[model samples]
Structure formats: structure tokens, C-alpha cells
Target: MEPEPTSQRTSANNSTYSAAGVDTAAGDLAVELMKSSVKATHGPEVMGGVGGFAGLFDASFLLSYRRPLLATSTDGVGTKVAIAQAIDKHDTIGQDLVGMVVDDIAVVGAKPLFMTDYIACGKVVPNRIADIVRGVADACSATGTALVGGETAEHPGLLGVDDYDVAGAATGVVEADGVLGAELVRDGDVVLALGSSGLHSNGYSLVRHILSVAGLGYGDRSEDLGATWGEALLEPTRLYTSPLLRLIEKLPGGVHSLSHVTGGGIAANLARVLPVGNWSEIDRSTWSPSPVFRVLNDIAGTSLESSEGTWNLGIGFLAVVSPDVASEAISTLAEDGIPAWQVGTVGTGSRPSGDFESGAKGVDGGAVRLIGTYRDGAK
Candidate 1:
């Protein structure tokens, strides 16, 4: 009998397994496009350039202090990337990734030294990679951190061509004695707060849900928010690290607890510093929130009573500072080109009976709580 056609047999066998979706050539193109932006951000501290098996940072320079404690934080941009993808904006997430991680590490009183990122995509696109790395470089330069390296994995089958995820690790340094947390927070110490640009990485799940109900998508400008939906949602996360690092360098290590405003917002993040039964009650009226918050609030129909337990609203990073230095620190941050503002003073409390107290208002007596916590719209 004639031998079975060779082509038919090969085709039959291959059809069962199917082709892996990732395009190898596409990954190469993506890497090539991002090379320029990547090199520009590299510093002498970076031992080997990008595309290495692992990033190398020679921290001998960081060993100047007798007791150097390394502060490392790993974070992702959260669901905010979804909004970005919706708008076809990929560059800003780079800054978002770096900002999110550095904010977390900085709270421990560490000066961010180096950062590495990981980008995973189902299908690699060159310009998209450029957009992301550029954002990362901007964040690194702004935070006084070096963009040492990162990973770009194109998983066609896993990530889905249109889907991607971004994450980063920021390593910083602080003297062993300089860690800030519940230890330095005391009653009447004053909770100095800094304002946020908008929804800075957290609450996007809620933001998306609310906007969906409102039959809205990003890019619509609402009179209440004063900007297009894309503008507010894509606002790059602010990094207090650069300014805070400079200030903490001169501080007495008494600057106290740092609350990074992220997934939890002000109430939840500040809660991390609660010592034993010590409660943190913030005044919601401390600083006027940006219009974007109001837009979300209106869309979510959120309440003050619920806010303390839910979102950051406007407060970004909370510096548990002494009453005297609070103003100066805030002023110093402003001088550094950061829009810093004092929102509330730290105090003891149980919980708010009436509301989440706003602005620089809250009592530190026993049983701490915000003055007004929205409860079923009663107060």
C-alpha cells in the first residue's frame, strides 16, 4: 500500500496540541523598543543592565551607616490597571507600580534606594512596553530611587493578549533605630496628613463598579470632578518618599507611624498603627477632598459613617508626627514640590458616634473614634 501522506499525519498530530499563543518575535520587539528608556534610568549602582537573569545592585554605598536596616516593599497597581487598559494608556502604570511600592516602604522610615519591576502580558507589544518602563523611570527619578531592573514575560496562553499585570519591589534603607510605627504614636501627638492626587491605586474595584452602575466609562468629564474620567482615574500615584526621605533624615526618629494610603485609604491604613486598644479617630473635614472623590462618593453614594471604614477619600500618606514638626514637615514637603497638607492630628478614641471628623479635628481621649462615622445615614 502506498505510504500515508506524510503531511496528513503531521497535521493530525499537531492539531490536538494546538499552538501556544505567545509570539516569540513579538517579545523580542517589545524588549527592543524599551531598551532606550531602560538604559537612560540606569545608574552606576546598577551592576548589570536589564535582561539579566537577575538584577544586581551593589549596595556597598548603602552600608555607610553602622546599623543599616533594609526596608523592602512589594506591591501591584491593583485593579487600577483595568481602567488604564480601558483607555489604552499603558505608560502611567509604570509610575503607579513604583509609587505603590515605595509608599509602603517609605512608611517604615526608609529612603528608597532601588526598584525592580515585573511586567507580564499575554501578547507583547513594543510601544506598550515603552509606555510602562517610561512611567517606571519617571517614578524612580522622582522618588530618588534607581530603576535597577525588571522582568517582561509574554504569556500568550496565560495573560491573554489584551491583559497584563504590573508589580514592583522597592528596597530602601533606614537606621535600625529609625523604624516608624505604633511605637512613636502617642495620644495628642497629632496625626499630620498629606493630601492625595485622586484614587491612588486602591478602590478601583469600587470605582469601576460604581461607574458601571452609573452607565459610565472612563474619559467622561463630570462637572463635580473638574476633569475627564480618564484624567482622574489615570492620575499618577504620588510618592511622598523623596520629600519624606529628606525630612526624616533630619528628624529625631520621632516622626512616628507612617500610614501609606493605598487599598485601605486613610482609616484602614492608619488602623495599622493602632497600639493595643489605642484607636485612631480622624476628622474627615481636615482638608477639603479633591473633586474626584466627590464624584466617586456621589456615584457610590458613600457616607461619612462608612468612609472611615472604607476608602482613603483624599488623605494619601499619614505622618505620625510631633505637634511642632507636623507643620514644618508639611511645609517642607510643599517646598519640595509636593502638594502636602496637614489633615488631622493623631489622638486616642474608640469610634465616631456622629461622623468621621474632618480636617485637623479629632479627640485623643480614651475610646478613640472619628467624631462622625456615617451610620445608616442617621448622623
Candidate 2:
């Protein structure tokens, strides 16, 4: 026993965990890189800044409300991240994440208080992670939500080095009586279609498939789109929370229900928030689908109607309101740069004989269908 073979033991222990692909140092750097952006979203309500084990938000303000209802939503940016990774653009994806998560909370007519993000990646690239978090922070700030805390996880063998996904959960507060839903929808409530920025964090799987079959690459520019395929498709989801919240406040009891036009498409989403047995005929002639929708349909040699269930078409959110205040809501949203218009009216009478989408997402609510031709003459 020559001192327990000290030299061999030293050599055997020399290989570090970093050598196994996990770099604690890189993770630390990433935290440092994203710290400022995360802190920028904080207000006086957020206690104990970033890098905390758990986020602290001031909820004492809820005491002022007669009854405060806490609303929480969690969602990811779907397959949209594929395009972001393809184009090496990490910035806008986080905005899409916030849109997916925080906007859902807004659907209940709640004001978001704070949010936390989680990033899963094969490796920690400080600048890229920072770019992603910065995007989330900016969107959170835009929606008046604090970016309290988040986690950046590195899975060396699980995900690709260049591949990452973003998800977030947000908490919001709304008065108990102010919570919006199908119960508030009336027989003649007007439906307003809030225009979407672009794809807005949904239906990318189909989009990518169509582009791939059409021999299009993310870097390829399309004259119809006025930018590279990735750039056009990567348009960040519009944060409707702030504007919609303002509209709700400005017009008391005017906005009955709000349906975020996400996955399940327009008819399904709208139907989910309408009273049971009540229905709506979404007149397509109200507005035209944007050029992006048209170009993709054209490339796929399919009708816009085909993707109706998979895409938002042009609408991003739907508002059911009293007819008296519908015009005002439209004008208010328009002034806020969100083009909105009357798409249809909730009806309790017999609907035309057709396949109406109802009970979508297991919500046995109302029936909805698209009638009339699109403004662009697409059926």
C-alpha cells in the first residue's frame, strides 16, 4: 500500500461533470445574462428580485376587492419554436410564449400580476438564452406583468444543442363578479373579431409541412410574404391582455365574454365560450384573411376553408358584447390598433342545416359555423 496510490486516484477524479456535457459554469453565466431583463419586468410588487428559489408577489392589494379571484394559465409556444430555432431567432419566441400563457388569463378578464418562465435546452448558450428571456421580459412589461422568477434547465442528451423550447405560467387577479365567461353571453350579443398579427404561436406543424412540400426553406424569401419564410412565420403573438383589459374597464358590463382564438381555431374557440344551445354564424365576409394565410393556402393548393380548424385565419380573439356597446368596443379596439369588427351574433333560434362546430375541447357549450364567403372571395 504505497499511500493508497495517490497519483492514480488524482488522475481518476480529474474528469469533471462539465466533461460529461453539463456545464454549471455556463448555466451560471446564462443566469447572469438574463438577470437584467428579468428584473426590468419587476415592479414594487415583486419582492426579492431575480435568482430566488421561489418568486414572491404582493397579494395584499387583493384585500381592497370585494372578492378577488386568482386566475392562472400555463402554455408553451407549440411547434412555433421549430421555426425560431431554424432561423436562429430566439427573441420573438418568448413573446409568443407570453401571448399563449398570459393571454389565456386575460380571457377571464383578469389582470396579470406576475409570471414565471421555464426554458429547456440541450445546452446553455448564454446569449441565446438571454435573448429569449429578454423577449419574455419585454412582453411581460407590455402586458404589465412582472417576470418574477424562472428556470433554465440543460439536458445534455435529451434535446439538441441548437434546439430549445419555452413555456410560461402567469397568475392574474380579477374581481369575482368581473370574471367573464359563457354565462354572461346574451342571445343577441355581438361578436367582434380582433385581428391577429400573423400566425401567433399556433399551427406551425402544418405550416412547416406545407413549406417543406413546396420546397421552401426558412431562409428563402417569398415575394408574397415580403420577407424570408421564417421571418414572416415568426411574427410574435400579439399580447391582447392590456388592450382587452382596458376595453373591459372602459365599457362596464359591455363585454360579456372573451374567447382567445388559439388552437381549436375560430369556430371551436368561440363556441366554447358561448351559452349552451346558443349558436353563432361567423360571417366570413366581415374581414379578409391576411396575405400570409392566402400565400400558404396557395402554396399548399388548398382552400382556406381547409385550414379553418387548424388556424386562426385572421381573428385572434372574440368578444361577445351587447349590441349597444359593440360599436364602441370595436372603435376602442381599433383606436388601440387592434382591428375589430362584428363577425356575428349569438342566436338561440334554429340554425341553418350544416355541420356546426360545437362542444370543442370537451366544453358542451354553443354551436358555431362560418357562413358566407370570405371578403377575398375564398369560400
Candidate 3:
């Protein structure tokens, strides 16, 4: 072969790290695109701008509390990102990340103060990065949290260009005596089930598997779903912080414990917040499962027992409240646009005689079981 021109050879060789799949310039551009969104979430509490090496927030508010307790939670939007990638929709996934991380802090009755995110991808696509951050910023703003900082890592040889994963951590503050869960939950407390927006970022591995086996693609539509598979599945997780926080403030000590239903479903998660000698029997007949869940179960030939353990199956959160305030709490959530209902009640059970950790912060968890059949009617 004839020798190539020197200028052409030099130009080709000068491509630098872009040729290796990492683009430094693109990363900088991505930061620029998302800077405004990140800063938009900041209030008087956020001290520095977006490009800081570390996020700075004013903790002076903590001094106001009689005894301040800090609560932190970290989580990631699991394989659900695969569906987002498959459908080329990047916006809603960040909400899923917030739902996973920030909402966990809310379970302890904390007020979310700030959040940071981490995204890993083979390439830093500026617009895609902006889309993800914008969603995060929106959710943070709604939850009164500052989107202080984030890291977008380019993994050249690891993830594919379209492959990416997002995770985040959040910190919040509450009065020491105001901390929720096992310590506050008691017998006869009514369980209020908060409605979910959809799957809410869990059980996606099985979701993808079931769809794969059924020969369905993200673009495919079903008469049962009334929308594209991707659209139905990608419904952003409901932001429960605002309403739940309002309930806490309104009811005071009436709101005993809170549980964010996630990976292990209603029973396991609800169990995490119950006292050692107390148990809850959830009435499945209280509310009907959302259409998406019913469709998934029917198509996959999965039993309710199997699906409930993996998916939310409709309920996103549960609030264990005193019976006297359950009606008011449900009405309050309803007025806030969240459809909530009395789903069950707490009961006493024999405690196992030993000092042990109760899956949650050294507190003891009681037995929890889902009883009754699912109501067939849709809400």
C-alpha cells in the first residue's frame, strides 16, 4: 500500500483520548449543560457553586433543634436503567435514583437537606447527562433538597456508550426524639398504604426477564397496558417526601413509623419498622393492584405471593399511624393528590427472647404477613 500523507497520519493520531472512548472536552461540556439545573436546586443553605470539589451546605439549621439527629441513605436505580436506555428516555431515571435514596431518609422522618449523584458510562453524552441531572434537580427541588454535586465518570473499556448506571446519597436532619420506625410503632396502629406511580425502580431484573421470555420489546404496546411497554414501566417513582413530611408536621407524634416499600416488597419492608413483639397483617383487599402490575402477573403466569416479594405491586409507602389519625392522614394525602387508604393494623406477637438486631439500626422487627386476596377492582 502507498504511504499515507504525513498531515493525515498526524491528524488521525491526534484524536487523543476520544479515540480511547473517553472525551474530556465532552465531560466539560456536559458539566456546563447541567450546571444551571444543579444550581437551581440550591437555596440559602447551599454555600458554593456547582463546580466545587465538594458540596458545601450550611448546617446552622441543625443548631436550632433541641437535639439534632442526622440521617443518611444511599441507593441506585438498578436494571431499570436498561429499559430507559432501550427506549432512549433519560429524563425519568434520575427521579428513580432520588426515590431510591432520598425517600429512604424520609422513612426516618428526616428533612432532606442535600443530595449528590454518581453516574458511570462509557461516554459522556452531554445532552443525556443534562437530562438525567435535570430530573434529579427537579425532584430535589420538590423535596426541599439541594442538588449540591455529582460525578459523571466515563468508563471507556467497561460500559458501552449507551450503557450507564446512576446512584446517589442524601443526608437529612431530624430531632432526636422525632426519629421514626420501630421505636414509635405500637399495637393497634393503623397501616396507611400510599399509592405508587408504578414499579418505582425495583425488581427490574425480573421485569426484563419476564418481558424477554414473553417476546416483548420496550416499544411494543399491549391492550392491557394502554401505552407502550416502556411508557408504562418508565413511570417516574412518586415523590412522597412532601406529602409524608406534611403529614408528620400535621399529626406530630400520631405518625408513628414509616416504611418505603422497595426490593423486598410490602411485608418485608413493613416488617423492618415494626417493634420486636408486634406484627402487622396487611389486608390485600383494601386496594386493587395497579394495571401494570396485574398485566405483568397475568402475562408472566406469576402468583401474587411471588410478585409481592419482588415488586411493590402498587403500594409505594406505608405509614403506621394511630387509629385516631388514620382517617385524617388518608384525607390529607388525598388532598395532596396521593390516594391513600387504611390497609392494615399492627398486632402484638410473642417476642423471641434474645438481644438481636432487627435488620434496621439494631431495633427489633416484628413478623409481617400479607393476608386476604387482592381486590380485583381498580382504583
Q: Where in model 2 is the C-alpha error above 4 Å?
A: 1-15, 377-379
Rank list by lDDT: 2, 3, 1
> Superposing all C-alpha atoms, what RMSD in Å does each candidate have to the true structure?
8.2, 6.3, 6.6
Candidate number with the higher TM-score (1 or 2): 2
lDDT of model 3 at residue 80?
A: 90
| Candidate 1 per-residue C-alpha lDDT over 28-64 given as tens digits, one digit per residue, 9 for 90 to 100 | 5666667666667667877766566566777888658
* Backbone atom clashes (below 3 Å) for every candidate: 31, 0, 0
**Candidate 1 segments whose C-alpha is farther than 4 A from its true place:** 1-19, 347-368, 372-379
Q: Give the C-alpha lDDT of model 3.
A: 0.85
Query: Can you write out model 2's per-residue Cα lDDT over 1-379, one digit (the tens) per residue?
Result: 0011111223344347567566666666777788878888888888886666788887889989999999999999989999988989989888999999999999999999999888888887878988998999999999999998788877778898888888889999999999999999988889999999988988999999999999999999999879999999999998899999999999999999999999989999999999888999999998899889999999999998999999999899999999999989989998888989899999997877999998588888899999888886422
- The whole-model C-alpha lDDT of candidate 2 against the native structure comes to 0.87
Tell me the lDDT of model 3 at 371.
74
What C-alpha lDDT values do all the predictions have? 0.70, 0.87, 0.85
Ranking by TM-score: 2, 3, 1
Better of 2 and 3 by lDDT: 2
Which one wins by TM-score: 2 or 3?
2
Model 1 TM: 0.84
> For each candidate, what TM-score against the reference?
0.84, 0.95, 0.92
Top lDDT prediction, candidate number? 2
